[model samples]
Target: MDRKTKIALGGGCHWCTEAVFQSLKGVNKVEQGYVASHGINSNFSEAVIVHFQPEKISLKTLIEVHLLTHKSTSNHSMRIKYRSAIYTFSEVQQKEALSLLDEFKSKSDSNIITQVYPFSAFEPSRNEIQNYYRQNPEKPFCKQFINPKLQLLLQHFSNYVNEDNIKHTDQK
Candidate 1:
């Protein structure tokens, strides 16, 4: 069996991030959750823990998709809780994320404010919140916010998308 690896990401809302990663082919699972907490304070930024097949999808690709899908350059004033972040589980993951950040920064003039931090803990979101886009596609928020992001994923990362998600998206 292929070895799987995991990474935690915080990009705006967990619902949107979870939906995007779930569509990818090599992603074994995506759990919406809160990460890097501190007891009752629970720095608990909305995040997703992605379990994936390294042979099928490189961590670099996942990070790239993440940066592209979210507004990494925007100030967090509109939604302080939704700051962009990449929480690494190991030194290797942190290095890869930082390398990607440099690469992305070199490519674009916009400041990439996506924070990189060591992974502390993850508290899964309520069941109702998991698989949100799949469960509530018709909701105005999903249609207005998520659908476009999904379309962008399909357009730019067509090879990474799951065939089932493509068919489901097509039927809509």
Candidate 2:
């Protein structure tokens, strides 16, 4: 098994995507960063570098998790920079991604606008953003934005949470 471990992603903003994926069961860590954003440079867009155990989570499952996260909060249009996306690192990921779009198109009644960027570059986000929601849970961004998204995460991805650090999203 190839067991690819990381996927670069940017969904509107990192805080929301990070908050959600950071709680997934197989995911080891979700690092905030940027991917191509300049057209072919979609990798330049803000992203979350997800580290996971491929043994536990298939690439398809990761993509599904991403799409689910996107669907949950997409009503507010926070999925672009805050929008949901999965940046592909391989041809398999690419094909699987295209398959996902096709699957979503057939299953849903709404038009979806998301970026599927090929690998390019990833500049780790600033230290302040490393865990913006956790460190400043009382801040406006956390209270207004991150928290609302967290509500979505809790409602949907609760199984991924570790009771000991359920609020790690606010602390890290």
Best TM-score among the predictions, by candidate number: 1
Prediction-by-prediction clash tally: 0, 27
lDDT of each: 0.82, 0.65
- For 82-167, candidate 1 gives per-residue lDDT tens digits of 75888889888899888887888789889988877888888899887888988887888877778777888888998998857634
Off by over 4 Å in 1: 37-42, 166-172
Prediction 1 global C-alpha lDDT:
0.82
Candidate 2: global Cα-lDDT? 0.65
User: Model 1: how far is 25 from its true place, Å?
Assistant: 0.6
Residue-by-residue lDDT tens digits, candidate 2, 17-65: 7766666677888888776644634435567889888887666666656
